[model samples]
Target: MKIKEIQDEIVEEFSHFEDWKEKYEYLIELGNSIELIDKQNKIDSNLIKGCQSKLWLYAELQNDKIIYTADSEAIITKGIAAILLRVFSNQTAKDILNSDIKYIEAIGLKEHLSPTRANGLVSMIRQIKYYALALNTN
Candidate 1:
């Protein structure tokens, strides 16, 4: 699906939950459902900086699309990365770079998160963009 479409779906999903607790449970579920990153790829180089928890992001280009795989020591952080990957994975580099993930605000994710996790979310986004930028010219 297109990034906007996927994001809208996420917003819709979040709307069903009336409270933060349910949102958090969904985040944990998302995190658990994420495909595991290769153990080898979970190296220092893949670790995103600025996150209080260890978050590793790995990406590669295949058939002109970028594939993202990530794992975080923190469940919420992992879920946050999963949300981003849901929008970005298997997408073209340009699409990933140009897409605006408004679902963050739509779902009030940042406000609901601890300040540290919020910063981690931002770092995760930066890492995804950096990967797209580096791979776009290839």
Candidate 2:
């Protein structure tokens, strides 16, 4: 699916929950389903710096698409990473770079997160976009 389509699907999924508590539970479930990254890839180079918890993210270009693999020390952070990967992974660098990820606000995620987690989310997005920019230029 296109990035927008995947994001829309996520929005629809989140809309089913009646409250933030339910939404957080769903995020945990999403995090639990994230495919584990290889141990070798979970090194310092991949770690996202601004996050309170350790979040390791890696991206590689395969067949003109950016493939992402990630893991996190925190469950909520992991879930956030998984959601981002679901939308950005296996997509062209151009697509990833152009994506605004508006679904984050649409799903009411930013308002629900603690300030630190929100910063982490912003850092994660910047890192993902950086990866896309680097890959697109190479």
Candidate 3:
């Protein structure tokens, strides 16, 4: 699906929950459902900086689409990354770079997160974009 379409779907999904606790449980579920990254790919180079928890992101270009795989020591972080990968993965580099992920704000996730996790989220997004930028040119 297109990025906006996927994001809108997420917004709809989050709207079903009335409270943060339920939302958090949903996040855990998303994290658990994330496609597992290879153990070898979880290396120091893939680790995203600025996150309070250890988070690793690996990306590769496959058939002109970027595939993202991530893991985090913290469940919430992993879940957040899963959300991001769900939106950005299997997409063209330009599409990933140009897409605006407004669902984060629309779902009120950023405000509810701890400041550190919020920063981690930003870092994760930035790193994903950086990967797209680097790979898009090739």
Candidate 4:
């Protein structure tokens, strides 16, 4: 799917929950469901610096798409990474760079997160965009 389509799907999924508590529970479920990055990829170079908990993000270009893999010491952060990957992974570098990811706000995620977690989210996005910028071919 296109990035916008995936993001819209996420927004629709989150809309089913009645409250933030339910939303958080769903995020935790998402966190638990994902397979983590390979141990070899969990190097210091991949670690996101601003998060209170450790989050490692890695991206590589494959067939003109940027594939992402990540893990986090915190489940919520992991869930956030999973969501990002779902939207951006296997997409063209240009598509990743062009998508604004407004579903974050549409889903009411930013307001619900603690300040530190919000910063971590921003850092994660920056790192992904950095990868896209570096790998862009068009």
User: Best candidate, lDDT-wise?
Assistant: 3
CA lDDT for candidate 2: 0.86
Query: What do the candidate models score in CA lDDT, each in turn?
Result: 0.86, 0.86, 0.88, 0.86
lDDT of 4 by residue, 1-138 (tens): 999999999999999999989999989898887557889999998899888888898888889999888999889888888888889889999988888978988888875345465438888888899999999998
Residue 17, candidate 1: alpha-carbon lDDT? 97
lDDT minimum window of 10 residues, candidate 3: 110-119
On a 0 to 100 scale, what is the lDDT of residue 38 in model 3?
86
Task: Score residue 10 of candidate 1 by CA lDDT.
Answer: 93
Ranking by lDDT: 3, 2, 4, 1
| Tens digits of lDDT, candidate 3, 36-129 | 6789999999888888789899999899999999999988888898999999999999999889967999887866344454437888888999
TM-score of 2: 0.92
Q: Which tens-of-lDDT digit does each residue in 3-78 have in candidate 1?
A: 8899999999999998989999999999998877899999999888888788899999899999999999989878
